[model samples]
Target: MEKGQRMKIVTRTRAGTITGLMVVVLVLAGLALPAVAPRSLIQDLFFILTMLSLAQVWNLLAGYGGLVSVGQQAFVGIGAYAMFAMVILFGWDPVPAVLVGGVAAVILAVPTAFFAFRLQGAYFAIGTWVIAEVTRLLVAQWKALGGGTGTSLPREATSDIMGVELIRTLFDVREAAARDILAYWLALILTVCIIGGIYWLLKNRLGLALAAVRDNTEAARSVGIDTTRLKWAVFLIAAFATGLIGALIYVQTARISPDAAFSLTDWTAYVIFIVVIGGIGTLEGPIIGVIVFFVLQSALSDYGAWYLLTLGLLAIAVMLFAPKGLWGLIAARTGLRLFPVQRRLVGHDINGGK
Candidate 1:
């Protein structure tokens, strides 16, 4: 062996490379879906992307940050309302209004964290739920936004939305088709950004510190890691992202109401189900989880109670038998990763060494 042979540390594998390439192909294909897919199909994909984005954000906070929040619908509702208020009162365009939604969520999160952080475990979850309820009640009193009856995006508002005209001209489709396509693209971009941003964070020193904080808070503190600050950051960031997604969802629907916007089942419970059924910690988990969720909804949603029961049982089975999730199972068997963040060390054996 050579005396000065070199070694390499790689974070990605050959299989991971292939997996990544496949993902790129799929994303590119998805971008073109509006051209060939029906309006309903585009809407369906938009729903999946938006939900997946929410699940990914939740997983980052609870699965990785150890901040389990049961009232994420708070941010969603606030964000959606903020956008509605902007469009209705201020005449802001929907595209730029989403940013305001994110900012509003972050603002709401600050006070919320001050209260919720004082509690632990189940108490913290309850604290969040209470906060969400309070927010819903407050929003319900804002008569300008139709009080509780809700309101729809006026035809003029929807028609003049950013990129709608361009999309209509580009695709030679109706106004509704253009809107669906625009929403789908926005959802796709948001999901990719959330997953990519989280992956990048997890590959840095912050990831290691966050992991330590998650495993044992006191232990992390003993090593001088600011566990409290890290947790707060994760919570606020998740809230901000969730708010943006919520606003986008409402924009796509062109309708809003307090109950629907803040519904536990629609915004929080279903998101939790998606994250749990997907693998919790890994980025791929939510990706797989959302796919599974979509399939289940497509087939069993008509059954109502039976559909929910099946989902409940499926989550329980995953928890009991495959605690890591479907993605975890596949990864265990094939060692394939699309977003490989785990580090590995590889080196040649020294010449004539044992």
Candidate 2:
């Protein structure tokens, strides 16, 4: 103990520095993947990146904001539908229409939060799902978009998208394959932005307020934290991101349907599984979870019902044994944190006591 010593707050660790370097290298590789990788591989990566983005948003809602919404597919569906409307009705390009999807999701979130925020626990989850179902029913009635059966992006829309031509010429691939590459690149960029943004938020004051609210609402309120506002921010942000992801997904597929776009199993249930299996509260959880899920899906997809059963069993086993998730267990044992967000105070002396 020295009188001249002072304490400074820090959030970085050796592991985090190393992880950041590794992430940069990985992202660079991902950016160049279309040059050498097979089209199938690129498609698979698009799936992984989009799913990871969805899982992270869900984690932010349920894990950080204490808002467990099971109707997230509503945003995904609405976003996709909005993109479709832009392309089919107004002759807009699909690329820019994706932004409209995000805006649409935020629009949906306002009324959704107004209603669902009043409920608690399981009721909130159910209320969200109910709202999604209603949205789906309404979307199914839009005859211009093929009514209940859904519709495809016009041939011109898909063939003449913004960046597909550049990719086709540069990579010397067909229009379809070039579109895949473009979508894959966009997915990579979106994922990097979402993950980096969330990490940044977690290292800032808003993250502290979010954590306080999540841990104890009354306590955070006593300290003058506006809990409702925080929750709304988290909800709306998640909605916007999810919507963008949804629109991108449909752009890649060049098709949209009410049932498929709003599927609970695809958008919400699977995302919840990813977060729960990977570790809900940590940034690394979704990364680890999505990898595991993709592997399982690849191996067991042929088994149909058994595949789902195995996933359910595995999730239950993890809940019972790991509780905090696979990454949580690994972190507990190895103290590895690729994305460290917790603050620590360290002492240093004025006399250069390094």
Reference-based TM-score of each model: 0.94, 0.97
The models' CA-based lDDT, in order, is 0.89, 0.93
Model 2 regions more than 4 Å off: 1-4, 349-354
Best by TM-score: 2
By summed lDDT, which 10 consecutive residues of candidate 2 come out lowest? 345-354
Over 146-216, each residue of candidate 1 has an lDDT whose tens digit, in order, gives 88888887777888999999999999999888998999999998888888788888888777788888788
Q: Clashing residue pairs in candidate 1, if any?
A: none
Clash totals in order: 0, 0
How does candidate 1 fare on TM-score?
A: 0.94
Give the range of the ten consecutive residues with the poorest summed lDDT in model 1.
Answer: 345-354
lDDT tens digits, residues 54-148, model 2?
Answer: 99999999989889999999999999999999999999999999999999999999999999999999999999999999999999999999989
